[model samples]
Target: MGELVERVDERDRVLGVVDRAEAERRRWMHRIATTICRDPIGRILVLRRAEQHARFPGHYDVMVGGAVNVGESYEDAAARELAEELGADVPVRFMFKFLCLDGVGPVWFGVHEAVISQPLVPDASEIAWNAWLTELELREVVDRWPFVPGGREALRRYLVSGNEPARPRSAERSPRPAAMPPG
Candidate 1:
């Protein structure tokens, strides 16, 4: 038995509990809670998945999150994932929820955001590289990087919502390594 997740319908109504792997294998809808972390100065945190990650290996992601466990609210799952992945325990503001029908599978993605004030302790098993980038820098990277499909969609919707904070003129752009092809 692996991690258990609630199998849901298109309307996000819980049908029953299933192991996370079973849900994925059966193409059942499940909930994934994701959080976009930004610095106090508004730089978004981006991460490259480690090569050994079960899904989207060697891909880039703008959010850190995972499958929501059975009986967990989206908000609680978002906070838990942020802490598990980045070692940050900040308050997360729920942004929105949408059905993501990407190659990863159909999932109700609950998007959240937090301003992280503490240093990150990324789990090496999950994250190969991480950096804080201005929105402009992130945009450039997205154009060339093979990002995780669902996260890419989430970012697209988030950007369209115009909820992102304004970037200061003095915010420096960090140089990113060349993008690697997704494995």
Candidate 2:
């Protein structure tokens, strides 16, 4: 079955729903949700997208997430994505949402964070590999490893918040106005 995606306007108001292919073909804005998972010791979880996947195949991503289906809330999507990709159902707290420019159109990206207490079992179909890295470790290899642009931006935002797993209320409620370069 084709995926039904929630379509939105420039300001992120819902316009209607469309199939994923049509949404991509028309460059329609749509919703996506991601979660930055951290181990109890504070190491962040990172994963590489499967090489066989479409869109930045084989690239590293800092979070586990995917497109929000029609009628699904971002928070629900975040949890669903975490479970689907990593087989971990950690309690994720919503961080923020921003309009990110992508190859097709602007994506209403909702980010969340959680400290995981259980071991993650990666789904091989979606993830090629996974790792838990400290802030310094991530910094050391980030420049050399190719990361998905939007995930990189989200990681940067996480770091800017003083390495906090969750975003501050002020920043989460109000993201910057400009379109973030997917770097």
Candidate 3:
């Protein structure tokens, strides 16, 4: 038996719990909670997936995340994934979610962002290598790198929105964009 994940519908309503493998095999919609981390100077943290990873092995990814466990809120899953993968216990702000049409199957991708102030201890099972790249550097290499397909789509949507995570005590409040309509 593998990890249990919530099977979701097109509107992201939970249908039932299913094994992660079963969900993938059936092409069932599910939820993935992802976080984009940035340094204080605004460089995005990017990492290469470990070669042993089951999905997109050795590919670069700007988003750090995984499947949302059954009954977990997107926010909680985002924070949990950040701590597990990067060892950063930071607060993450929910940005937006979209139905990712690309990749192995459709999933409601909950996107979040965090500014990491603590040192990172990358998990060997998940990250092979990591680096902080300026937005310009990331944009330049995004096309050339063998990036994960779903992550690439997330990044595209994020960049287009031009919204940054709110810093503590910042008065600026960006309006949340409506969820992307299912294609």
Candidate 4:
């Protein structure tokens, strides 16, 4: 699920879409679009990849996500991911945008807030584990868990704004509990 596809932004101007492969391969300007999804208790959504995943296998990831499909709008992709990964149809609210050079490529991610947080049904082949955490706790875990390198800052801006993101905190749930496991 290397859905790190992004737009070729010429400083915030829509140039064109580039495939994740080309962007990563050529170090082109690109961004991994994602959504800051929340749970019923105001907890943010997190996901874990199955052991069989080719990349970042067995790592914990938080975000209702996927690649921005060709010809798809960011909001549409976010809404689609909410339903596909969380098993809920969420109406996306446009928030902010994060600009970061993911090292491999530049990401202009469109941050959006879902209207509601609902139970998830992650794609078995993609999500290994999933959970919800307070914004404070999200920062703490980023320090302890193997999160995507650029996720912390983006998560911070998207969730708590300028406030430091929660990291290196204990998890309220086990890595894989009775909850649904990433297939």
Cα lDDT tens digits, model 3, 1-183, are 899999999899989999988888889999999999888876678888999999898988989999998889999999999999999999999999999867767889999999997899999999988887666667777877889988888888887888643332323212321121121
Pairs in steric clash, model 1: none
| Model 2 per-residue lDDT at 8 | 94
lDDT of 4 at 119: 49
Tens-digit lDDT track of model 4 for 1-183: 454454566575556666677666776766445677765555677677678875567777665565667667778888887777667786887677767665344666666777464446777877767766665656567767777655656676665564223332454533433243334
| lDDT digits (tens) for residues 1-183 of candidate 2 | 499998999988999888987887788899999999888766678788898977788898887899998899999999999999889877889987877785444788899998898877898889988777666667666666888888888888778866575322342222221212233
Overall lDDT per candidate, in order of appearance:
0.87, 0.80, 0.84, 0.63
* Selected candidate, larger TM-score, 1 vs 4: 1
Ranking by TM-score: 1, 3, 2, 4
Q: Tell me the spans in candidate 2 whose CA falls farther than 4 Å from its real position.
A: 166-183
Leading candidate by lDDT: 1
Worst 10 residues of 4 by lDDT: 162-171
| Model 1, backbone clash pairs (residues 3+ apart or across chains), number | 0
**Evaluation by lDDT, superior candidate among 2 and 3:** 3
Cα deviation at 121, candidate 3, in Å, is: 0.3
For model 3, the local distance difference test gives 0.84
